[model samples]
Target: MRRFRHFTSSDSTSEINISPLIDVVFILLIFFIVTTVFVDEAGVEVNKPRAASSEDLEKNAILIAVTANGRVYQGGRNIGVGGVRSVIAALLEGDEEMPVIIQGDADANHGTIVKVIDAAKIAGAKSVSLATVK
Candidate 1:
């Protein structure tokens, strides 16, 4: 009687298996896609002053409106000068580098516009700009 020996091959590989990593990445992508909140502007109608050289501004900016009556508004809601700082501070909590645009009525008081600018700066905004009509 002859004894037969069985031969087996071994997998001695040092490379990492990346299939699980790829799956995790895909799952994260899907989670972000589903859980991300998109902010859309919904506010009072502003009668923006018209300007011949007004350029188109980038959307999704922090708008601070100064009405002709010296009233301040943020996101279309009435916010007085004292409240401006707090509102801007709240908005900047997520992004301190957020841009602020002051949309003052052409007939609005210059002093009011200045106050808005000052409040925006105090709120830690990187850039504070005026909004002009085009």
Candidate 2:
């Protein structure tokens, strides 16, 4: 009876302190905000082909897209293969190890893809990958 009375006593503090929990949640939120990486897409949207061997790529890589009509876009600008070479050359000057990824529409011409890859290589891009959906 004494133990029950103690548990039921109004003098006992029964409120849960949530300040620490709130502080922890805020810290986690800030950490996620700082570590988040936003993917920047080229201006054009392409229906990427499906490939079973497709793999994830680094978020920092440059994205190049070839529309079904064979027009190329980079950084929201219409830059053809010639522009790709020049732009990639400038980018490689800053960071030679930067990778380039090409997003080609499923119905886009194969020749265009090859041309973009060749342009990237000519611009001193050590790593060039084709983007595809899995």
Candidate 3:
């Protein structure tokens, strides 16, 4: 006589797949890169006044540059003194709290800087500051 035996065994394993998570991360990275805002540089040449303890200011500002020749510039474009009021008014029309920064050349006339400040104030700017290099 022969005896037969039957045996059964079960194997269990657990693992986590992270490939989908990695794909989602990459997609988010691409989306942010495409929608990110880039700040444009002010192309005008300005010889900023130097200060002993000048600090960096917020980049979200309206820059009004006064060259040594007494020319006024808004974002590097020549906007004459007569246009200063209008330009500043237009810029502050939507955001009255926008800050106005005057970048005056070291050799620029003091009166010109004063005029710029006055125009900015009349244009409804909440704050006005001078730009200086340290």
Report clashes for each candidate as comma-separated counts. Answer: 1, 0, 0
Report the Cα RMSD per candidate. Answer: 7.2, 5.6, 5.1
Identify the superior model by TM-score, candidate 1 or candidate 2.
2
lDDT tens string, model 1, 1-77?
A: 99999876686657999999999999999999998766434154456777777666554578787888888887768
Measured on C-alpha atoms, candidate 2 has an lDDT of: 0.89
Error of 1 at 52 (Å): 5.3
What C-alpha lDDT does candidate 3 achieve relative to the native structure?
0.84
State the lDDT of candidate 3 residue by residue for 10-115, as single tens digits: 5656679999999999999999999886653344778888888877765577888898999998877888888888988998887787788888889999999999
Clashing pairs in 1: 51-133
lDDT of 2 at 25: 100
Backbone clash pairs for candidate 3 read none
What ranking emerges by lDDT with the best candidate at the front?
A: 2, 3, 1
TM-scores, one per candidate: 0.63, 0.71, 0.71
lDDT (0 to 1) per candidate:
0.79, 0.89, 0.84
lDDT of 2 by residue, 1-134 (tens): 35544356677677899999999999999999999987777878899999999889755888899999989999899998779999889877877887999999999999999999999999899999999998
In terms of lDDT, the best-performing candidate is 2
Kindly provide the TM-score of model 3 when superposed on the true structure, using C-alpha atoms.
0.71
Pairwise lDDT winner, candidates 1 and 3: 3
